[model samples]
Target: MAIAKFAGGWAFNSKAMVADAWHSIADLASDILTLATVSVSLKPPSERFPLGFGKIESLGSLGVSSMLLIGGCYMGWESAITLYAHFDPESAHHILEHIGHGHSHSHSHSAADLGIPSLHAAWLAGGTILIKEWLYHATMKVARERKSSVLASNAVHHRVDSLTGIVTLAAILGANALESAAWLDPVGGLLISIMVINAGFGNTVASLYELVDQSIDKEVKSSIRKQAQKALANIRDGHEAEVRDVSGVKSGQNYLVDLELAVPGSWTIDGVKDLEDTVRTQLAAKVRGVRRVRVRFLSRDAPDDKKYAEFIPGSPGALPEEEGSSKQNDELVDGHSDKHKH
Candidate 1:
């Protein structure tokens, strides 16, 4: 679509078609980002990135949005200069007199060219409108199902491209039909630039939010919490441990959960291990995109060990035999031994 639009745009003297072609180029860049992120972002967690490589998809989407923003800005600037020239040819010619041939001609020609837009450019624009619109629908459907931010961003780009194609097609047909309405081409270009910029800026902001480890939606988090609470319901009744809190972090398309647990100081290591396994298994199985679950055990009575150790039994018989025999000499040598307590 881009190649055809570019050729037809220049050949038919349609500035709007050329701008739309560049929009198609931006779509290609977005596709590149999508392809690059697919494999890398799905990688399993590593020592350096214990939470996994999901953020790579967000970074790739950011790159796509940045390109669209810069490209749109540049295209808008160029279209603005052309519009200025088209409105007042004499003034624009004098204003760009000192500029180099390469720079001045590019803008002046698009603005001052008297040739009407051709049917070829109109056909190219119309064709791209259909293509981009279809791609937008298809990609957006997959994005929603997979909860993929990058795919969603790219899908938005495709929708913008389709909209720009519509504007380009109308402008081309209008310019061809009305001899004095040549300015419509640059106007269409300007409108498309704004649309592209809006899409880019919005997606860029969203990606940055993800990069900062933004929390997921309240409803989604609540759903996850409900499912987790149910998972713990069975064990909470039998054990001395209870769930203290459940928090989560959003990374790209996935979520990482932190499960804070309050366990009795007498809770054995085996019990804690069982709790960890149960929480992780249930959350990962029941919740969508639960990539990691970290459980923290807080002991209620463990802090009193120091106070208990301070007491020295009066009788050696009160202690375990081997322990009493070994520690008896130390206790006799000094009524208190810091080493023994420690």
Candidate 2:
């Protein structure tokens, strides 16, 4: 699509088609990255990567959006330069000479005299729109079925490409129909650039939030809380289990839930462990995309702060440090320190 549109744009001197070609090129790159990331992210967890390779999808989205932003800026710059050159007498005369026409403002040049090529470009753009619209629907179906955000983003990219094709088609048709409306071609290019830039920026920000472990939707958290409470209420033990906190963050297509449960002090350690497993199982069954659950048990008489404290043992203002947290924290802090030093 990019090659065809680019060749047509060059042949017909249609800036809108040129801009659309650039967008198509970016979409090609985005598609490649999307496929690569999705494939890599599907790998099973290993000893080294206990959480699996989920964040790669977010990283790929960030790369794709950045490419889009750069492409849009370049297209906008080219269009602006072309529009500015149109007003310069020397530049306009040079353009006329390049098109094999004399610089006469007579407006009497017929299609045979001016060799109008915009019509053919318009037809090519129309073909592109049909193809891209089909691609969008096909990609969108898989994205929904898999609940994949990266695939959804790619589908949106296809839709945007189709819209750009539509704009290019319109610009070519309008310019061909009106003698004095030649400026519309570049104007259309500029508008498409703006839309592309806006989409890129929005996608970039969303991906960044995901990469940084942004919290999941509030409504989802609420639903999980309600479902978990109901599940806990079904336990026949005399000891009551209360949900202390429920939080979750998205990991690619799934969610990682952290739940704190408060139980009666009289519950035995074995009983507490069983309760945690039951809660985990219940939540996993109730939630749509829960990939993993981390359940923390707190005695009813424990301090409120301790209920939500970091599981790290020996940490100030936190619960007793777990056996391996100090080692993990040391490695984590050292890694960050080295990165900053570099």
Q: Taking the tens digit of each residue's C-alpha lDDT, what string does model 1 give over 1-342?
A: 789888887888887887888888888987887788878877899999988998988898799889889988988876776777767766565556655455646454543364467778887788888888899999999999987766786787788788888999898888778867877888888998998898789889988998998777787677777776777677754346666666677776678887767777787888778778877888887787788888777786654233224368588668465877878887776755665786
The sequence of per-residue lDDT tens digits that candidate 2 reaches over residues 90-203 is 564465557665646323222332333468898899999999999999989998998766677788889999999999998888878988677778788898899889978997
Off by over 4 Å in 2: 89-117, 145-150, 233-239, 282-288, 306-308, 311-342
Q: What is the alpha-carbon RMSD of candidate 2 to the true structure? A: 10.3
Alpha-carbon deviation at 236 in model 1, angstroms: 6.3
Deviation of model 2 at 94, angstroms:
14
- Give the TM-score (vs. native) of candidate 1: 0.75
What's the true lDDT of residue 113 in model 2?
Answer: 22
- Candidate 1 residue runs with Cα over 4 Å from true position: 94-115, 140-156, 177-179, 234-244, 262-266, 298-342
Give residue 272's error in model 2 in angstroms: 3.1
* Deviation in Å, model 2, residue 198 alpha carbon: 0.9
